[model samples]
Target: MRPTVTPCEDFNAEEDAKALKKAFKGFGTDEDAVIEIITKRSNEQRREIATVYKTMYGKDLVKDLRSELRGHFEDVIVALMLEPVEFQAKELHRAVSGLGTDELSIVEILGVHDNDEVVAISNAYEGLYQTSLESDIKGDTSGTLKRLLVGLSTGRRDESCDVNEEAAVKDAQALLQAGELLFAGTEESVFNSVLCQRARCQLRLIFDAYNNLVGHPIEKAIKNEFSGTVKDALLQLIECVRDRTSYLATRLHDSMAGIGTDDRTLIRIVVSRSEKDLEDIKEVYYEKYGKSLAERIADEEEVPSDVKKVLMQLLL
Candidate 1:
């Protein structure tokens, strides 16, 4: 079944502020209630609250929290109150601007997201900070990694304009021919034509044909044929067709179940997906790895326990 788009719930920021201020005033701290409502609220509601809180309380909601709370507890609370794109842009900007590139953070964030969201993040980053995210990536990263990040940031890497069965057939044929000849030129042409030019449904069918003829997943073939941005884009298309949740669940399990945890991937996945489908991901994680998502996360001690506990709560 296809996922249905529902309109976001309407929330009055001023109304919520009155309630929140009252709740905060009465108790020592309504930490439990704060977590409950904030985590459950839609991104639209969070944005509304951010504006309303400022007008109602004369302080940024996030700033107020920094003064009121500390540690992992504070991080999750503040995170729940920001717009998703702004949050993502902040994460991306943080990932690269430091001494070393947070390549894993960049990969996990951009890799799991659909192209449209990526473009929104790009636009939001510029609007919020008056700096081009693409330029920051160019300045901060180098080599194949730089190419991959910039290509992703451009938001065109996954735009499929129109579906032509005739075109898909031709593109699939070209891919077969390229694999037959071991010609690098034909490989790129095949990728561009099928992955870039074809519509989503058309490309899905094209990939089916490609796999039937080659007896291997297109992902494996592209991994062998391409490098850098080209490779990332092709693999992204394959994963997009495959179940995204399972792909991410598998990623999370692998990142943590390894010799050492991939803290960035683990944190970003939990932070971003909890509201959308963390429960579904938990089920997928269990089925794929024969262990619950929570268990794997619990096993990874390198991350602070408070952080891990809050992550688990968000999914619940």
Candidate 2:
């Protein structure tokens, strides 16, 4: 189900004027209360609060937030105020612009987002940031990372298109020639042009054929052939077509059970994937570790305790 999109009147201009005044009236800023309301409010609420804050105080909520709170708390609050796509674009921009690209951030966003989100993020990045995300990425990154991000940002994340058998055969041949082809246009292009291009049922047969020819799972082949951002994008495309829940479960497992739990990765996967398959992930999580996914997350220390708690609530 889509998240509730209702406008929250309680957090709008008039109400927020009262709330913000109250928040700032007592003492050296009630930081916890600031988090409590902002984090709990719906996105519409946050946007409304931003408008209210500016009109009421003649200062931006983000600016006020920066002055009031410090560290990741501020990041999360500001992120909440921006529209979701714009927020994601900002995150993408941040991932690439600083000292070095955060490949993990790239992977989490690319892998978990739906195709429409990927396209929207691309458009939003260019329009809002006044620069092409792809160009920025190219300047910042190198090697396979560059290739993969460029391919994904080219706006072909969805595999739900038409399939031509003759084209599929030809593409399949090309993949074979490339020797463990991983690039989206190379192996993935062929698959989409063929298998995923076909009707869903027919696509299964095509996938079977692909496995027979490759002597490995197509998904596994892509995994082995790609790494970092590109590997993530290809895997997400395949998972979108094949099995969403299993794919998410695998990602969640990789995040927590590895050498270390990547807090950002863990948070992104749980927050984004929860809407699609929380119950299924819970089942898989239990089956895989003989424990609830929530329990595993709770035990992990890297991710913020509050974020873990929020994820647990979302899971439940």
Candidate 3:
């Protein structure tokens, strides 16, 4: 995956900090100066700048940015400032903490992350909140969703890239029996065991085998057999495993679509993917939506110019 932010050649954390301090000084904030410095620098550089800013100025960089910036712009800056795992942990906490669960956020975060990424987020969540990520997920969700999230939070998915053709066939047959062949309903544990535990490469092969066995895509089978949050979560996992970039592209489109922008979702995707796959996401977004992400953001009157500028920089 191509990253939008590569390290600057002459990166100096103290210089960047001083530049930022100058931006925030005097009668009015130099928003452009702030944007140029924060958005162009890589996340590692930003973290270093934050450290230097604290050491030199004795002020928290985030607090200073918060005091100067407002609304979605602040959201962009703050998200950019956080370590990736920490940001993901905070987003997951926010998703599960409110009155009703943000199931999509929960699914997106948990389903898309690989075992190591999940482990990092789980550890970060615990470190940040003084509680287990799994416990929060368990309390916030119920039924199959709770089961799936709790299981996924363990980060125990088989990470081997090797595929076993025989095992794939058996898993495929097992899915058919557990879902379509059952008289009452699908077997939840069967679905969990195969979907949650298999290596992603193995899961791909199994999905192909499943299509051949069932005479339809595994997704179609999943749709026919399951419903509600469980169905959504499972399908998201399949989609994420199959093509993570497309999955994220779809997410970015969803965040910006209709009514008003889901700022949290927008910020999360932009911030998290900026240093990982935002470049590929931008490509997929254009191919899928027939308009560049930057163009789409440029057209949105609701997004403030400062926030849009920062987002566009990340897209670049």
What is the TM-score of each predicted model, taking all chains together? 0.75, 0.73, 0.96
- State how far residue 251 of model 2 sits from its true place (Å): 3.4
Give the runs in model 2 whose Cα sits over 4 Å from its true position: 2-13, 28-32, 114-116, 157-170, 180-206, 219-241, 258-261, 270-289, 306-316
- Model 1 agreement with the true structure over 22-107: per-residue lDDT tens digits: 65764466666566556556667766877888887797877766666666567666776677788898888888776977765676
Model 3 is weakest, by summed lDDT over 10 consecutive residues, at: 103-112
User: What lDDT does candidate 1 reach at residue 45?
Assistant: 79
Question: Per lDDT, what order, best first?
Answer: 3, 1, 2
Q: Write the per-residue lDDT of candidate 2 for residues 2-62, one digit (tens) a residue.
A: 3312344554457765676677765578765665566556666777778877877788877
Pick the TM-score winner: 3
Where is model 3 more than 4 Å wrong at Cα?
none
Residues 1-316, model 3: lDDT tens digits = 8888887888999999999999988997999998899888888999999999999999999999999988888888988898889989999999999699888887788777888899999999999999999888888888888888787788899998789999999999999999998999888888888888899889999999999997899999889988987788888888888888999899888888898888888878888888888899999989999999889889887778888888888888
Alpha-carbon shift of residue 78 in model 3 (angstroms): 0.8
